[model samples]
Target: MMRYTLNKMLLRLQNRYNYDVRYQQDLLQTDLAAFLKFMAFQSMSSHQGNLAAAPLYAARLRAIIFEDCGPCTQLVVNMALEAGVSAAMLRAIIEHDLHQLPEDIALVVQFTELVLAHQPQADLLREKIMALWGSKGLMAIGFAISSYRVYPALKYALGYGKTCSRIQLNDASLVPNRAAVVAAEAQNVE
Candidate 1:
């Protein structure tokens, strides 16, 4: 009965987001204990605390693009739009046009990039974030960047992850900049 309810809920999620949740379903079938644990983790990933929607979603979208350039990325974009982030700002983040974004949002984007790239330079940006949004807001950004990547990681581990592709937002199909990935890879090799 619990499995049936969980399956129904997953279907509702898929229909609502137009996303693939086969990997989640696989978890449900293969391991009920793990599936329950995964659902608990979702609460952390959805935490925004005191951070406003724009910066929170900004961190999420940027972090997601690093791990996933396909449907999962699109899902975050859709969620951001629904959370009321401006379309233009979303475009700037996707295009890596940090100059055009408002200073706070650009800070979040740059911070997320640095953290994901494992660069210590994010410390200064983290300080700025704390000053603007308080420590809880800073924690919100931390959870946003860290937890959102788990979805794509799980999908890929389950063989449901797809190759990178253009993400559709409104009428425009935008591709996230690959330069960050390249730079991260280059750093990893050194």
Candidate 2:
């Protein structure tokens, strides 16, 4: 068995995906602000001081591993403020405790954990994935999520990311009683 360092593994992932994500060069751009915000938030949320920042990078690391991680991926999810991953998802993986997730979504959640945890006996991830889902299934599992916890939230949050406007409105009539407009019409008829 080979002991794979995180960077070494990431390099392997980069080779597979055909692009290098140079840390400072790739992740420090203005466009990646959303992702950085997400990472900083995750780090704070985890209360781990620094390790919480793990999720922020985990998402991008996933894109590096797979060819087609979504645009919202981690960066968009964070920008949109919908990156709140469900605890249930994590619990489910622990419950199933299987080598691979039968559902495509389950696989990503589990594998993402595996990658993040830097678990050894690593290649076993591919083997179990293959057993559960053939080549096509693996692609489906790697590329999708069971929840839109982030995507839709990203849309609405980003919409409100800037200026806030308020509408001044008269009180809405909840009752069936007509307004003064109705009384004026009745007087005209008389």
Candidate 3:
């Protein structure tokens, strides 16, 4: 059950996005001011695109998967499919097979994983991204990854997030092995 009335603007945005807004509903009910602020921030941040749609979507999906934010991951998977990212690519990401992606997109996913994990290599990955896409492009990628973090945090904090969604449940191994990835990166660094 929702805790507050849906304002006209928010309702319109929800309709347009067609996203499940259970987290937003909880936020709105608990704190209208914060909800409005978050919406405004999202609106402005969403337009700061520097990466191409496909790679950007791939990076976001990677981050969502790393976070184990099931509902959010499902939402991103849907958006990626709608935006023409191949099902094969999405499956590879879900399965943690970064090598299956094209080189550039694979790099983006790797970078996103490092960022989400707060690995030291994140700095090196940023340098690689800058070399490929320049400063603004790096910023755009960072923003894209950062933006997706908010929803999962909100959902978890509000006690609404699940460990895994139905889509992720299709394969029990869909969950990423973050520790293994980090350890491998560390070995490479050493």
Candidate 4:
């Protein structure tokens, strides 16, 4: 979709302008295993949702995390801190959820749980992110990382990252409650 082409352009801009990185370098850095992990996250997209909506939701999540995380160098780390999810725990959760993606195709039943839990209130969230990342120049970083999430989802949809095993999803819903994986993992992924 042409919308996606714009998304690609946006990502390039974030890296080039914000991270001082070249597009090709970002592409090369993606490990097959990590890429697979992101794909699983994508699979959590709407099980009963329109194909388009799932990506939109994923984009929003990326936006929140990236903005919260400081986008350029410490994007992943700060998102984990603000959302209270840890990198290692996030790795484990992604591993779990990707392995058992929703059975159907329309709406991403599983990931809704995650989306709901992680979506932060703008009023409540901005300060913490600012304190950790600074208020000035924190623009569009969320858009960049949210966009980044698509990459892994694409990979997982294609099916990669098998060797990078972890617990995998279960009877549990993928909701983003305060006690949810993201919050609890905030303590640590260990």
> How would the candidate models be sorted by lDDT, starting from the highest?
1, 3, 2, 4
Residues 11-99, model 1: lDDT tens digits: 99899989888888999999999999999999999999998888998889888888864899898988889899889999998887877
**Candidate 3: where are CA atoms >4 Å away?**
1-19, 166-179, 188-190
**Which pairs clash (backbone N, Cα, C closer than 3 Å) in model 2?**
80-154
Query: For this target, which candidate reaches the highest TM-score against the unseen true structure?
Result: 1
User: lDDT of candidate 2 vs native?
Assistant: 0.35
What digit string (tens of lDDT, one per residue) describes model 4 on residues 1-190? 5434544665775554443223322333445455345445544431312223222333344333322222221333233334454443343323334333332210122222233346443334334334533433122223333454554343344443122211212232222212243453233211
Q: Write the per-residue lDDT of candidate 3 for residues 119-141, one digit (tens) a residue.
A: 88878778878998898888788
Ten-residue stretch with the least lDDT total in model 2: 160-169
**Residue runs of model 4 more than 4 Å from their true location after superposition:** 1-118, 135-137, 140-144, 161-179, 183-190
Question: What TM-score quantifies how close candidate 2 is to the native fold?
Answer: 0.25
TM-scores for all predictions: 0.93, 0.25, 0.80, 0.27
TM-score, candidate 4, is 0.27
Better of 1 and 4 by lDDT: 1
Candidate 1 — number of clashing residue pairs?
A: 0
Q: Which candidate should be chosen as best, given lDDT against the real structure?
A: 1
The per-residue C-alpha lDDT of model 1 at residue 159 equals: 91
Q: Per-model C-alpha lDDT, please?
A: 0.86, 0.35, 0.71, 0.34
